[model samples]
Target: MLRIHFAGEDIGRVRIAAGPVPAWEMLLSLHALRGPADHGVFGPWRARTLGVLDASARLLLRLAPPRGYSPDFLTPTADNDIDSLVDAVQSTARRRLRTDLGLLAAQRGPAVWMRPLADGDTTALRCVGTAMFRYHQRVLAPAWDRIHAVVMAERAARVADLLDGGVERMLSRLHPHIRWEAPVLSVTYPVRKELHLGGRGLLLVPSYFCWARPIALRDSGLDPVLVYPANRGLQRLVEPPDTSNGDSLAQLLGATRAAVLQEIGGAEGVTGTDLVRRLRISPASASEHATVLRRAGFIVSHRTANTVWHMPTPLGRAVLERDSGVRAGHGCQRSPARAGFTP
Candidate 1:
């Protein structure tokens, strides 16, 4: 169990990452390669990726074992962009690199190839960066659109929770394995550990590649982040919406109410006031629509101070996802240029 103790100031500091981090995704994808083949969801992706692995990819696999620790230096928090990530790893200070690599070695046995990296050889760092670039382009870039969609959908729900009830409420609903109990957030982990936030707050990062439980940085001294599995619904991402079914749903519920449902799902943490403005409906009408949605279990409304925030429930999101007009957009911004390493 990993227990994270929070302070008073930490309540106001919790944040969710805007999008996926390429460096973190790269390492986590490698770990996914070694996961159980019967997981069903990632089976097809795993087959396709494994067929394309090369020497450079294998070099990374040596350090990021399926079941154990991966050096933290590989994932830099300075920025989330792929280009920045590659640069961060390549330019990592010798001391930090040496320390992280040393920890990796201590956890897993000594590896002869890791010697150069631990010694902070510039060439070895370049090789690491080169591997990351190639692996990302080959493994991640192809399916990025689908991955981005799923993660963004998850983020929207989480952001809504944060807006509705603040950091405490958001933390409580992070995942089944995570429990937020007042001053401490307990997470189920394979090992025992404790982390005191000391008011730096926690960054909640939703990851497509993470499975089972959440993962945290080994070194507690770094900026706190919890990378948890995003709700996949991958098949839904690729399939075309059934407009006929959506139209039927609209008929069953009043057309106006259906529109309200779509609007609630499409918008992140919309309020009754926002609904009134966006839909050009009267305040009472907006409240009525939201109340109906909430009572029917299609949406959840939370009162925050003077305002009440609204978001779709899983069932409501499912209905909206089937509507062609409510298709989710990609969350991660497009990279300015394809990232490359000059090894």
Candidate 2:
């Protein structure tokens, strides 16, 4: 069990990441690749990644295990910028690198390369960084847009929860294994431990490929960060919809409109560009359909910064569910309207 004791000041300081952190995703996905062959959800992606993985890319496996410790320098913080994160890894202090590597070596038994890595060998560190960059290019770059969309959608949902019932409701619903009890938040960890926040608060990062349970940094002295798995429905963001359903729905609603609806149905908080990429439709066409749908009271569109996210209203979900032959209550749950969208 892992317990986090929070102070009054910590409540307002808790934050959710804007998107998936590149380095953390790279590390966790590598761990997932090494695990058992239950790739039913990610089978196509796994196959594609395996085909492109070269000798340099395979070196990342040594840094991350299927189950166990990974060095902290690999994922310095929950920053989402890939370039900055790679630089941080390369610039990790020699003392911290040696200490973190030694801890990993102790747990997994010494690897022959551990000595050089612990000795602050710049070549070894650069080699590891290069491998990480290659793996990201080969495995995650293609799907990053979709991955980010799912993460943002999840963040939007959590934000709604936070608004409706405050921190207690949001924290309790994070995962089935997590519980909020007064000033203490508890998680069922593989090992027994307690973390006193000391008022530094916590950073909540939602990950697309973080399997199963929530993970936290082993080092307590640093800021408290929790990496949790996003909702299971996020998988639909990567998968192509059923052909039969697509054809039937397209026939029911014109091809262009159906395609737009299908994409929005798969993932909420999607932008017009996302639709263009997924459907191979022109931007003008995507905008036209989104306007029509919004005007008809099927979907609601809102702008955050420069991007507009279209979310399916209850009426919209009913239309898709009825057309798809899904029972009314069984369709995707209607997400709450974002702050600016009109009813």
Candidate 3:
């Protein structure tokens, strides 16, 4: 952790002194550390701006989900394939991928700058480069290099690195007011066990479960050209996996109680005349749905005359698969009139 944080002064022995860190803390902290430090430096607003830019860059990638070879790490493999025929075909695959991404970088350079700012204000540009290097050379590059003579995996990394590299180079070209937290803070989050490399995994849940949507995205097995260019590497933080500690769905939102939570477009306090106008449902329909979700413990409802407001519970967040934005069809709930609501 320290070595990664400093990016200097190798402290491999430090691990002996620290002992093994619990998987959870190690993973979450590493993940958090990857976040652009500008947020930590310029305060929340600048940090948020950094986050927004990062999202925009990522969104540009996701708007066009990698539509090639299934990025499915879980794909089933054949038990027996003769190695004799494998060598020639593998070599071909590598060159093809590299060429595709190289072409992409050349064509869409501006849309995909590696880093956000000109100055190397943040370490993500560097760290991500390293991570990409490792995941490629060690993980996929070797296999592809042998199978595809041109080393498709390595080329893909090179192309992505080159394009994003331009962004980093630009950062170096002009210095910006960069920020850093020399000694990092311990921001605890509930994470899976494997993330903890050291045994000191802390058990703490953040008060607010929902944060600005996680930017992770995975290629959904729908593309092929990406396989040729190691650029298949760009991973957008998409929807997170469900939490085990979170409340159960049925317990939170009863079977036939109120409206479905996933369908609620936006009914926070019913203050939005626009929502009323848009939904076009009588005040009764709207209020009833809010009431059901409230009763199911998915939301908290309060009545101020004709206006009723609803806020979600942590349980609702898990079911909605999000705590922040409820894009289109999220957090829907409806109570059967037979079940009853005063509205």
Number of the top candidate by lDDT?
1
- What would the per-residue lDDT of candidate 2 be over residues 236-321, giving only the tens digit for each residue? 22354444333332343677897787788767657788999989989998987887665554555544335556767565666676
The candidate, 2 or 3, that scores higher on TM-score is 2
CA lDDT for candidate 3: 0.29
Top TM-score: which candidate number? 2
Select the stronger candidate by TM-score from 1 and 3.
1
TM-score of each: 0.71, 0.74, 0.19
lDDT of each: 0.76, 0.75, 0.29
Query: Which residues of candidate 2, in runs, are more than 4 Å off?
Result: 234-241, 246-343
**Worst 10-residue lDDT window, candidate 3:** 224-233
Which is superior by lDDT, 2 or 3? 2
lDDT of 3 by residue, 1-343 (tens): 1111222221121111011111111122223333555433213322333343332234223212232211121111111122211222122233333443344444455334422312232343333233333332332332221222112222222223336644233212111111123322112222211121132211111101012211111222212101111111121122123454243334434432223354442332233243345556566655555544544445443222243334444445444544332333355543353124321
| Deviation from truth (RMSD, Å), model 1 | 9.8
